[model samples]
Target chain A: MTTQQLHEQILQKKSFLCVGLDPDLNKIPQHLLETEDPIFEFNKTIIDATHDLTVGYKPNTAFFEAYGIKGWVSLQKTISYINEKFPEIFTIADAKRGDIGNTSSMYAKAFFEDLNFDSVTVAPYMGKDSVEPFLAFENKHTIMLALTSNEGAFDFQTLETNGKELYKQVLETSKTWKNSHNLMYVVGATKAEYFTEIRKIVPDSFLLVPGIGAQGGSLSEVCKYGMNDKVGLLVNSARAIIYASNGTDFAEKAREEALKVQQEMKEIINSKF
Target chain B: MTTQQLHEQILQKKSFLCVGLDPDLNKIPQHLLETEDPIFEFNKTIIDATHDLTVGYKPNTAFFEAYGIKGWVSLQKTISYINEKFPEIFTIADAKRGDIGNTSSMYAKAFFEDLNFDSVTVAPYMGKDSVEPFLAFENKHTIMLALTSNEGAFDFQTLETNGKELYKQVLETSKTWKNSHNLMYVVGATKAEYFTEIRKIVPDSFLLVPGIGAQGGSLSEVCKYGMNDKVGLLVNSARAIIYASNGTDFAEKAREEALKVQQEMKEIINSKF
Candidate 1:
């Protein structure tokens, strides 16, 4: 989906919320395990329950991959379900994948072509050749990691490279790449102050913000600095929403959690616009 | 397999050659397409042909993931085949995956426990928390990217951070992680001189050197600079050997190419050790 279409969806729903579908067998409801494909079933219900309150679904590939082939099957089913039922909703494959040029093309093909995710997250360690392949695909977004939410983000990302931080260098270097308009960024919500600095590099580009709720990031703080004129922020909440309740009413409880975030986002949009 | 066991195998074979299993449907012989699992069939033949000459097999996950569920299944079968048949050979899941602490744990479980790879490649862009989980695994090796073979490696890796280059800081910081014994580094063959500096920080840690033939890296130069007392190198060649001949004699021709590399490695091992 184009950024314009994503912006339109944000306007219609009044929520830039992208519910992260990071389902784990141990954390999910016990009763769902009896089903043939518990992961898909859990995701199906959660997507159904919260689709109206969110603009997108970001499924971290590690959760599915941990279960082996069965997990991959569930991931495939979940993605297919989202695309078919809610065609307008943006989908993000939060698989932080990057390799050399040719190999990265294969990854771009897998996520964008085969799985049909609107975007896939990429690591910037390998630089331009690693990312340019994903950008080559028109309209299909490549959300590169700028500043992550985890404690590790400080290790190398914040370290100064040539006068500026490495991530700032990353954002600046990325804009010069071929077909960079398709670029988006993954900036952790915990660093609200960094958004002010981040905006200076890529003013119009969208930022997929994780680290709210469970990770101790404030939605309002992220909005205060991160939000652009188009509301270019996908504030993701995974564990705080998805694992709110593991009982039979898990989906309903998830909706409740999502609704809370959506209400906050709606208020923010109402005030801003 | 432990590093001790891997080093022994390298000594026994007189070749630290890691045959990279990157099967593409378009590149593999047309006749294999008739098989039920063409990717698996191709990998099986390659493993069967080159197992003796090589000490390890590094399957680049992108090639398998590109095919979707079938691709994953092929990957599973290929790894199982290598473990069951050539139990002596070390295995590297060339999946450069890293995420936040919990997510990285899931990926470590997927590649180390579920997939049973001896080692798995990880990108260090996210830093400590993202990598320490993989290092937490008992005997499994975590090969972090230092200086990659591609041109993009120059983008951020060579940039000065603190008093040293970013990649050097990666090597130095990685050594402080828990279970640093399991730590390895991916230093691309294209930059042989960088290996000299890399060796200063990680003298004994095994360096999984790619870019040998296809990427224009020299084995002798890498050995002169990178190789430690225990022969700490697993030089990888993917396309050069595997895609040697796409005809019916593909496996045999692949063996021939591997044999040439093995011969060169044998001479190096004999002279050095």
Candidate 2:
């Protein structure tokens, strides 16, 4: 998906929220467990409930992968459902996949061809061979990790080299990759201050910002430093939305939570326009 | 598996060969296509024939993911077969997953908990949040991509910052992550020249090196620069080894290729030790 299309969606919906589909089997409503595929059922209801309020849906691959084959099946079903039903909404396979050239090419086929996600989160650690393959696919974006929202994020991402943080170096270096125009990055919401510096490197590229809601990051703070001319921020709220409730009204609660963020995004986006 | 166990197996077999299970359906033996699961059948034969020579089996997840559910089922069967028969052999789920804290924890559960892989490849772009969750798993190693073998690898990986390559920064920064003692790295064989520099920062960590054989990387040069006191290199050969013969002798031919690499590895080990 192009940044322009994402910008259009944000304007149309008046929202910049990206709801994350991270359904934990144990945390999902008990009633869903009775279904043949509880994970997909849970995801479908949430996608249905909040599709209009958000510009994109980010499905964390690990949740689906945990159920083994069943989990993976659910993931495929959920993605197909989204693609078929809400064609305008961007879909991200939050897989963070990267490998050597041939191996990475196959990954490109898996997510872009077979499964048909609009983008897949990739790791930039293997340099460009593993990452550039993902970028080669037309219209597909590669979301590389920049600054993350974990205690250990300070371990390496914040380390200074040549008077610049490592994350800054990643952002600057990415600009040189082939088809890197499609490159976006993951900058966690918790590190709101870093966005100021990150913007200097990638002023226009979209940022898939997680760690809002459940991770205790302030949404307003993120927008203060990270907002671009296009409102280039995909703020994700996973557990805070997917697990909002564990009862029959689980989907409704998810919508309620999504609506709250969407409402806030509307204000933040309007202030910019 | 731990470096000690991997080392012992390498010494016992006199081989440092890691056969990559990048089972391309189009490249499998034609006769195997007649089976209930052609991919599984192809993998079974290859494992049976070359199990003695190889200390590790690295399955690139993209091949299985490409076929959807059927491919994943085959992967399960293949891994189960290996674990049941060759319990001592190391298994790597070359998945290269990375994400946020909560999301990454789930990925760790997917590979380490559900799939039972000894190690899984991870992208370090998301910083510690994406990487630390993988490290949190006991005895399971997180193989971060340090350097990769591909034309585009030069794009971002080699970019100089602070007079050091981005990959060098990744290696140095990764050392500070929690449970990093269990961490390994993926340094491409084609980038053998950088191995001497890589070794200076991470002399003790095991490296899962790809890009040999079909990738045209010289094994001798890699061994010369990449090997450490523990011979900490798991050199992977995929297409060249698995597709050595696309006939009934495919598996046998795979063994032949594995044996050749194993013999060379033995000589290298003998000369070094």
Candidate 3:
């Protein structure tokens, strides 16, 4: 999807919520286990119940990978479900994949062409060659890891690099690369203050914000600092939305949880812009 | 496989050669594509031909993922073939994956358990929790990205952070993690001198050195600075060895190329130790 298309979806939904479709067998509803594909079933229902309320859906690849070949099939099916049904909904293959130039081109092909995701998250450790391949895919987004919402983010991201924080330098240096206009960034919502500094570097670029709800960052605080005139933020809530309940009402409960976030997002959007 | 087992394999093979199995459909011989599964067929022949010459087999995951589900199945078959036929070879899934704590656990399960790779490469941008899960698996290894061989490595890795390079900080901070013992690192062979500094932080750790032939890193220089008492390096050469020839004698040619590297390694080992 184009940035303009995503922006229109945000306006139409009155929210920038991206429900993370991270399915785990240990956490899904018991009844679904009887089905041939429990993971896809759970995701199908959740997407059905809440597709309109959110602008994006992120299926983290690791969760699917854990189950092996069948898990990969489930991932493919879930993505196909989204693209076929909710074509307007932005999709992210939350693969956290990056490698050398040639290897990275394969990853871009897997997510953008083969799986047909609108975007794929990439790690920044490999630098421009790893990132530029993903960017080379027309209109497909490459969300590079910046200040993540984990304790590990402090390990290298926050450390000062060349008179600035490493993450800040990542934010600055990436803009000069080829096809960097296709870049979006993954900035965790855990630290509201980081958003203030982050927005200063790349004010126009959309930031895919995870770590709200389950990770406990205020949506209002994230918006107060991170939101731009274009409403440049995708606040992701995974566990608190998807696994809201393990009962048969799992998807409905997920919708209810997502509804609460979407409603809050509606309020935040109306007030800000 | 345990680190001790890897050390033993290096001793027995008299080579720290890691043959990178990165089979591209466009690059493989025309005859292989006529088979039921070309990628696996190519990998099977290569493994059969070069099993004794190398101690490690690093299958970069991006190549397989590009082919979609069939590719995933092919990957499963290739790894299974290796485990059954060449049980002594240390397998490295060159999938540079890392995420938040819970998500990372799934990746750990995917590579270490589901696929049964001996080690998997991880991007360290997410910090401690992202890496710890991979280390949690018994006898499995997590090869963290340090200074990489690609041009992109200079983007953020070399940027000085807190008085040290970001990659250096990744090396230093990671040493304090829960399973530091299970950790190895990816130090590109391109800059052999970097090994002098990397060894200071991770003197005992095994370094998975890539960029030997295809990316142009000298093996002899890599060994001079990177080798330790146990020969502390799994120097990888993928395209130069595997794509040595696209003829009917492809695997034999691959074996010949591998033999050359193995011979060089044999000399390096004899001279160093």
Candidate 4:
């Protein structure tokens, strides 16, 4: 999935919300615990409920991975379900993977060819060889970590480097890498103030914005500076949506929360253009 | 595993070699392709051949991830095989995973709890919340990407931040994070010159050094500067070992390469103390 297709879907749905599937086993309903695969069952219902309201589904790999093989199976089923049922919805393997040259190539194959995610979140610390492999895959996007939304982000990303912030330098230097046209960036929603500056460096690239819902980042504040002409933003909400309820109504409540975000997104999209 | 355990193992083996399991499908012996699971078969043989010569096994997750479910299954088998047969050998899920606080906690659970890897490579872009989650796990270590081995690493890692290099600042700041006692760092062997400087800040921390062999980094130079009193270095050799041969003798040739490294490491270990 190219960014262009993502833009068209946003236009069609009038929403830019990306529901994050981060299923914590402990937080899941007791009813699901009775099932053969609680994670899969929970995810199936959530996808069933919220597929229409959102343009994307971002499954943070860690949540599924915690359960070991069972969690991984659930993750595969969730992506396969999204692909088969909601082909138009963009899918992200929120696996922040990055490594050296040869290793990065294999990672590209894993996420792009094997798991079949539209994009995968990657760390930029290893630089081009690590990142370019993900970008090399045709139509696949690489969401590089730019300005993250955590307190530690202030430690290094925002530290002044050569009279400029390091994240800003990451944004600027990444533009020169091979196949960078396929690049998108991960800019935390909590760092909304940095968006104005980030936008100047990556004027046209898509930004995967997390930290909006459970992380307490304001939707309006994120949109105020992060959105571009093509609605270049995928605001992800995990706990606030997926774990909205601990009962059979979990999926429906998830949809309700997703719907609320989609409604806000509709307004934001309308106001933008 | 803690750096202390790793250090003890290095001393006992008289080798600091961390043989990287980055089995590229195209590079594996053609005979293994006849098997139902070529990747696992190849990895098992390599592990069996080199287990005694090496102190640690570093599996780059991308290699297994590329093959899809089968690849991940192979990874599980490979790691399980090591754990059951050679429990003393340190295992690293060379997965540079870093994300939000909650998301990172789940990742920690994935590698440490589910998969049972001794440690994992983590990106430090998100700061404390992203990295601290991994460190929080008992007996599990987080190998934070500090100075990487890539052309573009110079672009950001070397950038001066308030008079200190960005990588230097990362090392200094990481010390203050919660549960930082378990934190290790990734210092590319290619950047051997910086090791003397890096050791100044992170004296006791273990450094996972890649960029040997195929990447043209000198093992002698790396040991000269990177080695601490505890042999605080895990010098990794991936392509040079795994792809040592494309014939059925691949395992034997891998053993030979691993032995050479072990011999060098033995000499280094003897000379250092």
Candidate 5:
């Protein structure tokens, strides 16, 4: 998806909420488990209910990969379903993948061409060659992990290097990479304060902020610092919204939870711009 | 596989060579394309031919994933084939995977518990929660990307932080993580000099050294600096060995290439002690 298209979708939906479709077998509604593919069934229902309220859907590959081939089939089905039905909804393959030059190219082909995701999250430890292949795909965004929401983020991302933080260096060096216009960044909502520095580096670029609801990051704090003129913040809330209820009306409950966040996002955008 | 078991296998094979099985559709023999599953067929032949010579087999996941669901099925069959046929050899899933707490757990289950890989490569960008989950698996190895061979490794890995290199910080901090015993590292063979310092922090840990043959790093240089008292190194050679020939004698040619590396490794071990 192009930057203009993504921005238009955000405005049209009146929300920047990117619903995270990380469905766990044990966490989904018990009724869906009896179906041929419970994960897809859950994601399909969630997408159907909340597609209009959100601008994007991110299905973290780890959730699908845990079940082996059967899980991968469900993952393919979910992405296919979304692309066919909700074409406007930006899809992200939250597979934090990176490797050598040729190997990274294979990964680029996997998520972008084969599975057909608009974006894939990548780890930046390996640097340019690993990330360049992902950026090589046109209209496909490479969401490099800058400051992750996890505690592990502190291990290397925040370490001071040459008078700047590691994540800052990542944002700086990434700007020089090929096709960097398609680049996006993953800055955890937990580190809302860091957005001040992050926005200074890549003001126009989109930011995929995870760790809002379940991970205890405040949506208001994230929007205050991370939001750009185009409202360039895809604030993701997964477990808190999707697993809002374990009852039969799980999808409906998910919509209610998403709408609440969407309403908050709408207010944030209105107040900011 | 346990540390002792892997060490014994290394000693028994008289080589620390880890043959990389990364089969590409266009690169494999043309006749294999006529088979039911070309990728698996290629992998099966390679494994059958070179299983005895190498102590480990590292399957880069991107090569399989680029082909989609069928590719994933091929990966499942390949791993199952390795485990069933050559239980003695250590298997490394060269899937550079890492994520948040629960998500990382899912990846751990996917590779270790589900796919049954003896070890899986993880990117250290995410930090503690991302890596600790993989370490949670008993007798399973978590080979982390410390100093990669590619030019990108220069990006964030070698950056100076706290009066130490970033990769050095990773080594120092990783020692304090839970289940540090399960930890191995990926220090690229291209930078053999870094091994001197890396060995200081992680003297006993097995380093899965790549960038040996095709990537243009000598095995002698890597072993000189990388080897531990346990003869700790699983030096990988992928394209140089697997794509040795594309004819009917492809497997035989692969063995010839692997045998050459095996003999070199045998000499390294003999001369080192």
Candidate 6:
């Protein structure tokens, strides 16, 4: 989906909340383990429960991948389910994939074409050539990692380079790449203050914020500093919502968690826009 | 496999040549396209032909991922074929994956446990927590991207940071992480001179060098500056070796190309050790 379509969905739903589908077999309800495809079943229920409350579903590819070929199958089913059931919902393949130019093209094809995710997260360490391939796809978004929510974000991202943080350099340099209009960014919600600086570089670009809920990032703080006129912030909440209750009411409980975030997001949008 | 075993295999084979299994459907012989699993069939023939000449096999994951579920099945079969047939050969999943601590563990588990690769390449844009989980795996290696082979490497990796290059800081900081002995690095062979400086921070670590044949990096230049007592390098050549022929003689032609690189590697090992 295009950013404009995503913005329209945000306005229509009165929510910019992106539910993270990071289903872990060990963490899912014990009863679901008997099912043929537990991961997909879990995700299906979550999507069924929370689809209307959220504008997007960001599936962390790592969780599915950890299960092997079976995992890939479950992942395929999950994405297909989302697309077929909720075409308007933005799909983010939180794969964090990037490589050399030709290789990166293969990745772009895998996530954007094969799996049909609206956007895929990518690491910016490989630079322009690695990313431009993803950008080449019109309407498909390439969410490049600017400043991650993890502790490791400080390792290289925060390093001072040419009188500015490396991530700022990444944001500025990325704006110059070919087909950069399709670019979005992965800016962590853990550092809400950084959004002020991040917005300066890519003022209109969407920011997929991950770190709220279980990661201890404040929704209010992120909205205060990060939200734009289009509400260009996809604040993701994974564990806190998905694994809310490991019982039969897991999906219901997940909706409860999602509804809380959606309610907050609705308030933010109503007050701002 | 342990680095010691990898070094021993390099000695026994008389070549540290890592045959990069980046099988592209468009490039593989037309005859194989008619097969049940063309990617696996292509990889099997290549492995059968060159297993004796090369000490390691590095499968670039993007090539497999591009095909979706079928691609992952091919990858599983290819890796399984190698482990069962040639148990001693070191396997590198050139996935270039890294994420948050927990997520990185999932990736490490996927590659090291599920995929059963001896090592996996990772992007070091994220800091210590992102990589340490990969290092936590016993006897498995995590090859973090230091300086890549592509032109984009110059964008962020070579940028000045903390009075040293970002790549240098990556190498130095990586050494301090827990179980760092399992750590290796992806140092592209495009700029051979960078090896001399990389060695200062990580003299003993095995460096998986790409950009050898197709990307115009010199093996001799890399060996001169990068090699140590363990002959610490797995020089990869994918397209130049694998795509040597597009006819029925493809496997034979690939073997011939691998032999040429193997012979060059043999000469380097003989001169040094």
What lDDT tens digits, residue by residue, belong to model 6 across residues B70-121?
9999999999999999999999999989889889989998999999999999
**Candidate 1 lDDT, A1-273, residue by residue in tens:** 899999999999999999999999999999999999999999999999999999999999999999999999999999999999999999999999999999999999999999999999999999999999999999899999999999999999999989999999999999999999999999999899999999989999999999998999999999999999999999999999999999998999999999999999999999989
**Model 3 Cα RMSD, 1 decimal:** 0.9
For B8-118, candidate 2 gives per-residue lDDT tens digits of 998888888898998888889888888999999998999999999999998889999988889899999988899899999999998878766777888889888888999
Worst 10 residues of 2 chain A by lDDT: A153-162
Off by over 4 Å in 6: none
Ranking by lDDT: 1, 6, 5, 3, 4, 2
What RMSD does model 5 have?
Answer: 0.8
What are the fnat scores of the candidates, in the order listed?
0.85, 0.69, 0.95, 0.87, 0.97, 0.87
lDDT of 6 by residue, A12-126 (tens): 9999999999888889999999999999999999999999999999998999889999999999999999999899999999999999999999999999999999999999998
- Docking quality category of candidate 6 according to DockQ thresholds: high
Q: Which ten residues in a row have the lowest lDDT in candidate 2 chain B?
A: B153-162
Q: Number of clashes in every candidate structure?
A: 0, 0, 0, 0, 2, 0
> Which runs in model 1 stand beyond 4 Å of their true positions?
none
The complex in candidate 2 yields a DockQ of 0.55
Colliding residue pairs in candidate 4: none
Complex DockQ, candidate 5? 0.94
Encode model 3's per-residue lDDT on A106-125: one tens digit a residue: 99999999999999999988
Ranking by DockQ: 5, 3, 1, 6, 4, 2
Model 3, residue B136: what's the lDDT? 92
The per-residue C-alpha lDDT of model 1 at residue B231 equals: 96
lDDT winner between candidates 1 and 5: 1
Which runs in model 2 stand beyond 4 Å of their true positions?
A1-3, A161-163, B151-169, B193-201, B270-273
Model 4 agreement with the true structure over B35-118: per-residue lDDT tens digits: 998988998999999999898999988887777777778989999999999999999998888887878888888899878999
